[model samples]
Target: MNNRLKSVISAAAIAVGLCFAPVQAADLPHVVILATGGTIAGTGATSTTTVGYTAAKLGVDKMIESVPELQKVAEVRGEQVAQIASESMTNEVWLKLAKRINQLLAQKDVDGIVVTHGTDTIEETAYFLDLVVKSKKPVVVVGSMRPSTAISADGPINLYNAVILAGSKEAVGKGVLVALNDQINAAREVTKSNTSTADTFRTPELGFLGYMQDNKAHFYRMSTRKNTADTEFDVSKLSSLPRVDIVYGYANMDRVAMDADIGAGAQGIVQAGVGDGSVAAQMMPAFRDARQKGVIVVRSSRVGNGIVARNGEANDDKEDFVVSDTLNAQKARILLMLALTKTHDTQAIQRMFYTY
Candidate 1:
């Protein structure tokens, strides 16, 4: 029991204990972040200037490094899908992202996915994945209203919460989720409501599925919408989605917009109409004519909430037009575009609005 023997025994014991200790980071779920540029990746002249900023200026590597807390929750990896404002996000990009997600999820190493998208169209992208992604693994879409350089920027924390949700067992089979502003919104239920605030996204009709507290996902409810593996639509084989446009209906709005969309080769048009999804007096003729010419017309409310009843004042039944249940115009447009990829039947399309 000399000093040298005592030191050797202590070193051996310490090495044995180290071998038994669990490596927390290595044991966590693996999440892949697909970064599509938005305010989250934006850069401004300074922290005080928020009105006009250059978005998608940062790449995936820089963004992943910004939130160090992400390492504690999951084994995160970053992939740059595109670096463009959400408004510039196109259908071609959607197909590419969806296909890539499917490919990644097929790997044994991937447990979930987190998509960093521009807030402008995050809902559309999330819902599209809900319909087409045929997996039970969690897919959380996240975005921020303020640029990364803004004062009190919400990007870092939002991205952190998104990673938390993607790693959570509670998020599986729950459709494509939208994680932002401490709220967990189902893709089918959430919409962006404000142009400049952290709390821009809201679920007006159905409300959020849950909220994040203490850096974890707290599930309160779940959506019954047909999404993820339950959805009938598939974008895997689709090379491109048909051209669908939105036509806003107002007090004196004319058929000019609808006519123009038809001229632009719109295969489907989402009419953001008045109360109860009613088509304006002057626009009904154009809608009917478009329906005759193989253009699918979907009546959705601009009022933000409530269902657009089938066969209601919009004359959806007689006009052979479809109705969007509670989908806002943007979401309605996404669904219509995906639905057209499957079938052209009016009843089938109507069923899509009701079920999805």
Candidate 2:
């Protein structure tokens, strides 16, 4: 055919193809998966070997590629944020991750975010992001108990459900969510209950926020506490978070740990005390010393669930200490770190513990 006829035919074909194309990718929700190495990205020696595996073996790209069904739910993309196990998660990584999420969610095209984290500290990271993200766009943190290379590797399905949850409009403004084993949990309340099980993450007392079933997210309740955009925390300019340490309380526990943390320049201390957040008599002196030296003290329970009532076992009023309403020791530490950045007043920090 002549050049003119060939060009005309090509243009016509292009136009026809455009008209027949399914909805463009731009029409779909743009969900970014930030991979912060965990069991979800882990690999085992054999399919049946669930334990004794290596973590952070796979990258975000590989995880995303393994889940083909994710494309139908959202415009998926992945970024490898960190390749460290969640137990080794540091404040530096937390700050960097939070800043990145805030930046991504601020873009008009980015609808939500899915974070693949280790189950060990996924809840802590999720709660940290929930308080500091400053965006209503859904952020779902998902992980797996089994390695991605296991026989029944739960990572792929969990990752898929996370993307679905992140892209859902109903999930927005409900705070950070933990999606795993077909369950949806609020970051503020979820905890890792089992060491090695698919259904490890749980909200024992209040129950999970919802579930991921039928390839979609279902919500039964939302976090009433302040979170996400509602929180006043801003980690944009922060290079590092305050030094906060958790001291586990036990029978005949001494103040050595508390004193050590204080001596090491801990800006805040979380007492993972016994029932009702009680402080051991020996630890009380160190707590008082910490308070005298301008270190914030927070009373949090080691128990799996329940509130650490203020002024119940410990004299919060006399000691000028803060109580973690429903926050566990680790989560309380996270909040106290952030709270220290804004204020040193015990009452203000205590209010943060209650509200956030």
Please report, in order, the local distance difference test score of every candidate based on alpha carbons. Answer: 0.90, 0.91
Off by over 4 Å in 1: 1-22
Candidate 2 overall lDDT versus native: 0.91
lDDT string, candidate 2, 1-356, tens digits? 89999999999999999999987777789999999999899998899888899999899999998999888889999999999889999999999999999999999999999999999999999999989998999999999999988987999999988998999998988999999999999999999998997888889879988888997788999889999999989989999988999999889889877888888989999989898898877778888988899999899888867888888998899999999998999999999999988999999998898899
Task: Evaluate model 1: give its TM-score.
Answer: 0.93
- Per-residue error for 187 in candidate 2, Å, reads 0.5
Poorest stretch of ten by lDDT in candidate 1: 310-319
TM-score of each: 0.93, 0.93
Give per-residue CA lDDT, model 1, range 1-356, as digits (tens).
99999999999999999999866776899999999999899989999868799999999999989988788889999999988999999999999999999999889899999999999899999989998898999999998888889898899999999998998898988989999999999998898888887888998867889999997789889998778888887777889999999998788888887898899999999988889888777777798899899999998989998988987885667889998988889999999998888898989999888999
**Candidate 1 clashing pairs, residues 3+ apart or interchain:** none
The deviation in Å at residue 219 for candidate 2 is: 0.6
